[model samples]
Target: MTVSNTRQQVKLSDAVQRIQPSGIRRFFDLASTMDNVISLGVGEPDFATPWNVREASIASLERGITSYTANAGLMELRSEISSYLKTNFGTSYSPENEVLVTVGASEGIDLALRATVNPGDEILIVEPCFVSYAPLVSLVGGVPIPVPTSIKNDFKVLSEEIEKRITNKTKGIMLSYPSNPTGAIMVKQELEEISKVIIEHDLLVISDEIYGELSYDSVHVSIPSIEGMWERTILISGFSKSYAMTGWRLGYVAGPEIYTKAMLKIHQYAMMCASTMAQYAAIEALKNGKEEMENMKVSYRQRRNYFVKALKDIGLNCHMPGGAFYAFPSITITGLTSEEFAEKLLLEEHVAVVPGNVFGSGGEGHIRCSYATSLPHLEEAIKRMDRFIKRTNG
Candidate 1:
């Protein structure tokens, strides 16, 4: 039979069609196309990976240890990861069954959502949060219910807010502390309050503590370490943030074997395992990179202090970020939406930032600026931003 005159287009999956492109990437890509643009957009550390960690990976390669690791990852790295989490996060796991190394915390997210989310299941995402959480939940056929948090509470998700949103369809909640967009963090007491709600609701938790090491004033608390949460929380973290190992693409998921085993099955099919060389490097980072890691933390803390003050001094009010390297400042005084502010700043001043609304509710009228850069760069960016605001507001 002859084909019809009108050609049919390849059908796309409903999941793929429903998801929109990353709002962060749109500005990042646009900035990339330009020169002399100082980007406070991407949330990546500026520090180089510690020398020992890099040397370990190089040594591994020299020894011809380039084979694919077991689907669950190299057992040695898993044990080290287990130890690291226990010491730092106060949460323990069995390296044998409770840990699965993946490509990145990003991949860990995909695995966790796919493994747990059933069609129509509702995953409660705390908003003004990471952009990936809701979309990943949606891609797995789960409904992502946004629980909005505002600057009034320093962007912390209150227990009452969580309790009010719970329903029969609610399966679990996604939490990111030292949050990507807002740099908001919940203290142990705050998390405990929310933990009570999660326990009462008998819900699962996906705690993205990738930025745990970047906490400024207080220790980062893991949900699994809280009472009644060990059995329900899946802890996702990795070398990307703490060790400046983003390019290494190494991350691990630790939780009850029931959840991790499911993630492993998916990891086996989708990714097989994380890089062997990176796993070797991560082992070194955990064992001997603490001094360098702490040094980076000190530098970030300095940058954060300077950047927050600089933003406020320029009349863009910002909450002092408790952790991570981002500063989400309200640009409402300039009479511009978040998108307009970010676009104009990038085009007019050649300084790049991510618009807040891209991060979900409570993000409107704000912009996420990463201070994970040199102090001089951050200072200059702020000066340019101040100039732009003065000129715009006038």
Candidate 2:
């Protein structure tokens, strides 16, 4: 090694340069450094993983089942997932050929994009969408075309809007319902209409149904279940939200065999398999965790109602979220941008919420408040937020 005046420069892929740090993570990073911060920033569920699920993982360990699984995952787990899908959503999938187990829905998103998109292809993303989709699309050399939805309609994307955004370059659409930032979900009829547009355009759909089990008022619809849509739709879901198993990092994607096989190839090369123990635990969750999932849904529904009411009472414009655990309340009444409102609230009241603009352009006037925390924390956060708002307005 010679010491020289000129140093070799490190290089990164253009794809890496095109992406930015997640906006949601920035708020958490700042909140972590402060004391007594009540964060509704991260979307993680606050509940502990259910006892039975934990026990299953422990049992797996006790049974010496700690080896790697097949790249597509264990056959029995896949079969359970396939059965669960049929039982819960009335969708049919062949576990042996159409499902690929992934590290998380995050990995499923990346793997699907990696397998399907080529340079300059466009992926349609609805605004106020999950933070990960755009970056992942860019990473896979696909252009992210965001279609902004409105708060007036509760952030629901219309079929016409989707049709308007399609172009010759459009390759697919990314759908996230019981959406991360907005908590908006598409009912069965709504999804059927959207599916028609997708079918007409001959486009692929990557449906992120990670929060499918958390709906409050109605059933969560899967676009793939619609006649003629299953072959073109890739459904991404996981145990993270529904089972409160974020740390377990278990998820899956089910679709036509042609696409899933391609996705599995990428999964096989990039990460051999999801954690073996987690997969085994997930098998138990799929097989025996229905009551536990329902219990969590009940608690989440109560918290969602409480927080939405509190926010509205405090003069923020809020819609009662139909699914997931977030309330996307407009911060405009406070006379601040979503980011400014969030920053001031954190500094003045030690309450943390993510600015809606982090999701996309349509979220500019809103902020996302998660009710995934305990009731006590939610109450305290509301009190602090009330004081901060009154003081600022006064």
**Model 2 misplacement above 4 A:** 1-5
TM-scores of the candidates in the order shown: 0.98, 0.98
What would the per-residue lDDT of candidate 2 be over residues 1-394, giving only the tens digit for each residue? 9779997898999889878998888788889999999998878899888889999999999999889999899999999999999988888999999988999999999999999999999999988988899999998789999988888888889999999999999999998998888899988888888888898889999999999999999998777888888889999999999999999999999999999999998899999999999998899899888899999899999999888999989989888788999999998877899899998899889999999998998899899998998999999999999998899889
lDDT of 1 by residue, 1-394 (tens): 8878997889999889989999999998999999999999978999889899999999999999999999999999999999988888788899999999999999998999999999999999999888898999999899999999988889999999999999999999999998988888988898899999999999999999999999999988887899899999988999999999999998989999999999999999988889999999999999999999999999999999999999999999999999999999999999999999999999999999999999996799999999999999998998899999999999
Error of 2 at 65 (Å): 1.5
lDDT to native, each model: 0.93, 0.91
- In angstroms, how far off is 91's CA in candidate 1? 1.0
Which pairs in model 2 have colliding backbones? Answer: none
Q: After superposition, how far is residue 317 of candidate 1 from its true place, in Å?
A: 0.9
RMSD in Å for all candidates: 1.3, 1.1
